[model samples]
Target chain A: GESVGLHLPTLSVQEGDNSIINCAYSNSASDYFIWYKQESGKGPQFIIDIRSNMDKRQGQRVTVLLNKTVKHLSLQIAATQPGDSAVYFCAENIKGNQGAQKLVFGQGTRLTINP
Target chain B: AAGVIQSPRHLIKEKRETATLKCYPIPRHDTVYWYQQGPGQDPQFLISFYEKMQSDKGSIPDRFSAQQFSDYHSELNMSSLELGDSALYFCASSPVLASTDTQYFGPGTRLTVL
Candidate 1:
């Protein structure tokens, strides 16, 4: 979608349409990546994930693409629905001390589905 | 499909007071993570535990500390609460066997510090 999606802030798409959200990361060592959706006043819900070795992965209506060359990640949602409106965040798994796994989350992009 | 559970969905405290937040992770999950989300801001990682041991630390303040028990449940204890501490706290759990460590989040606890 342009570049490693840096906090687009907001994206509006018509119902039944498709929209793409992008995220960029500087760490090439981050092997695992995840996409989470968070609604108002709610915790983040896992949507999909892709590893550094893979370029694309799909789940339900969501597709996550990883471009290791550019350290870019994008989530494509097909057939946007009303219930899909929420803040989307991209997180990369960066290992800490002793086999520890913690996610480094990017600033989210608020997606609004218009009817 | 059991999801993570967070206690006291909401909490209110006065400045300099103490607060305790608890999290019950999904069955068999070995890792628990905590995050803080300020109003209109993205979630920030606080800390994480693996197999009841401290695994990683993030931007958690000195007054905030957390631990995971043998049962895999975790608690976050905060002292000297400040108004700036008011925010949404989220807990996520993941099974160690999963290669991706896909975390499942529980409904957040909204804490208000007066």
Candidate 2:
């Protein structure tokens, strides 16, 4: 079975510094990608998403870059803050019949903001 | 500004007991998805429903079943629960008809099988 994975299990960054999290996926057929942030004891919150047609997308203070050739994805957060500390996951959207899409999440990376 | 809602913030059950979880999606969202997350693990897709019908299936076990209602809410039923079934269950929703719809997740229900 194809899987999505993160290169780093944990990441530490100083407050106000920029942070980057990387992910690798095995399925080339994946057409959409998303980044989610999960705080402790809560469900995942949608951060941003990009379709295969676009290589990069930007949200407020956050950017997601997708490299189709390498099957790689990365999330960059600017001005890291304590509230930004959480488990981040990258997900691939596998299209299904009738325009349905199923999300496959990768092993998450725990981001820590060092105040 | 409404978000997905789930019932029974927490549940405790013994082995072989049955458990039922409910989900209320955001208003006007027609598609619902269920996921399970073990400790320190990423969320795993279980199943999904679109317009009160099963839309997709994932690693859901035979002991579990789910359905979307006419009102667009969904429920997950687990029978003969085992200790390993303990985890955080999350429900998400999206409007499949939209071109750029994104799945928004609920706060989740914590199920503890004793």
Candidate 3:
């Protein structure tokens, strides 16, 4: 389950509903992780990030939960909106010696918000 | 500051042809990285450059190579391309060498192999 989670490639949710997207990482050594959103015909846009030292981090209407024991990462969006419809991806970083910019990514999950 | 920029926003090539993609890191940034994104998939690391040299390369084939110039710009070269090489290539830049350093990504170059 190392790959990014997208149980449903396209999730249809009524506007204002909460959204939860999951990701599984294989590298337990990954000390840092980030979530990115990519709209159609565009590159990924940075969202929020969480460090291994912490279990959860919250941003404006977004929360990232990290479970080290299960090697799971999840992004929870509160009050989903149409603009939230995009492909979301989670990336892991292992800072052994290669450095910080070398990140491994998981498969993207396409999220759709219904009107 | 302006974000990362990539050249040849779209490219089309035939099998056995060679393709070169260029990237310009963000202003004042020193680290550059290249990643490949297949349809409906996340971006995968291809290679990284720091201090104007190759620092790390993923499981990409030998035909796929990269070079850095003056520690600010980088190029990814694919020689003898195959149909399977078609994918959206992205360039990312980060300021320092810290694990928590945030990475900024370029729009990406869509490569189509015919």
Candidate 4:
């Protein structure tokens, strides 16, 4: 079965510095990728997403870069804040055996912000 | 502006017992999905309902079953719960008619099996 995975299990960064979370997917046919933020005791929240047709997409303070050749994806957060402290997960939208929307998620990267 | 709603903030059951979790999708949303998050792990897809039908099911065991009602409300039933069944369950909804991939999730239900 296809799976999505992250390189780092945890990342620590200064409050004012940038943070990068990396993810890799095994399915080359995946057409869409999304980043989600999960706070303690809460469900995953949609952050940003990019389609395979595009290489990069940007949100308010978040950017997603996708590399098709390497099946690597990254989420970059600018000026990391305390509120940004959470578990980050990347999911890939791929076709299912029954022809449905299937999202394969990575293990996740826990981001910790230092004062 | 109603969002996804899940019932039973927390639940505890003994081994071999059955547990049922519920979810109410945002009104008018055509798609509903269920996910499970084990301790120290990311959310994993369990099953999904769209257009009042079973759309997808992940690699979960057969003991896990789900149903979507005409009102767009969904329920996940886990029979013969085991210790490994302990996890956080989330419900989500999105517009199926649109190509948008944005999914809004509920607060989530924490299940603990003894």
Per-prediction share of native contacts kept: 0.58, 0.57, 0.75, 0.55
Displacement of the residue B44 alpha carbon in candidate 3, Å: 1.3
All candidates in order of TM-score, best leading:
2, 1, 4, 3
Question: Following a full C-alpha superposition, what root-mean-square deviation does model 1 have from the true structure?
Answer: 2.6
Cα lDDT tens digits for candidate 3, A1-115: 2344445566777899999988888877778999999998787889999999999999999999999999899999999989999988888875635664577777778888989
DockQ of each: 0.63, 0.65, 0.68, 0.59
Q: By descending DockQ, how would the candidates be arranged?
A: 3, 2, 1, 4
Candidate 2 CAPRI classification by DockQ: medium
For model 3, the superposed segments whose C-alpha errors exceed 4 Å read: A1-8
Candidate 1 chain B worst ten-residue window by lDDT = B95-104
Q: Please, what are the lDDT tens digits per residue for candidate 4 over residues A28-71?
A: 98888999999999988889999999999999889999999999
- For candidate 2, report its TM-score: 0.97
Candidate 1 global CA lDDT score: 0.90
Q: If both were scored by TM-score, which would come out higher, candidate 2 or candidate 3? A: 2
Q: Residue A2 CA error for candidate 3 (Å)? A: 6.4
The pairs that clash in candidate 4 are none
Candidate 2 Cα outliers beyond 4 Å, as residue runs: B97-100
lDDT of 3 by residue, B8-44 (tens): 9999999999999999999998888899988877788
Second chain TM-score, each model: 0.97, 0.96, 0.96, 0.95
- Error (Å) of candidate 4 at residue B86 is 0.5
- In the range B1-114, model 1's lDDT, one tens digit per residue, is 889999989999999999999999999888999999999877788999988988889899999999999999999999999999999999999989344779889998999999
Question: What local distance difference test score does each model get?
Answer: 0.90, 0.93, 0.86, 0.89
